[model samples]
Target: MKQSSTMRLSRLVFLYAAARLAVVAGCAGAAVAGVRLFGLEVSLTWVLLVGVLAGIAVSLLALRRLRTRINDEIRIVDNRRQDPSKRPRP
Candidate 1:
């Protein structure tokens, strides 16, 4: 069965957002653990900076997967737009 374009787009967006949130959370947790366990004197700003950098790194790594999914959805949408017969019947 074919999936709707909106459904595909929504799924991709949701996945991307979830991945980003996970990255940020993971980084923050790690930074907190380092400070607590190692007795490292770290400021909130340093922790946040590390988190942001880690988040960007994670996002970059995941970008290819996200791009592929997005591209596939876009291609499906474009094909549907070009072919009236493939469009949903109302």
Candidate 2:
């Protein structure tokens, strides 16, 4: 029932969050490496800021399918919740 579906939704959300965090970290590492490769100095704070922005952009494209699936599932769950007749029996 609702509990099972909710758990599934929670898992999807957790996966999405983890993916975003990983991308952000990867971007930060890349930023650091890129700067060093050019023999340029940059503040860590600025580099992290750039990384987060880049991560957001990349994730918006790369994670589109996953995001869509999550949204669809949320919509489904919400519909079921709003329509008591559609809700599963305990």
Residue-pair clashes per candidate, as listed?
0, 0
For candidate 2, the TM-score is 0.88
Q: Can you write out model 2's per-residue Cα lDDT over 1-90, one digit (the tens) per residue?
A: 345667778899999999988887888889888888998888878888898899888988888898998998898889989999998799
Worst 10 residues of 1 by lDDT: 55-64
Q: What C-alpha lDDT values do all the predictions have?
A: 0.81, 0.86
Full-model lDDT, candidate 1: 0.81
RMSD of each: 2.3, 2.2
Worst 10 residues of 2 by lDDT: 1-10
Model 2 CA lDDT for position 32: 80
lDDT of 2: 0.86
How do the residues 1-90 of candidate 1 rate in per-residue lDDT, one tens digit apiece? 976797888889788888888877888778777777988888978887887788778776867679688888888888988999998789
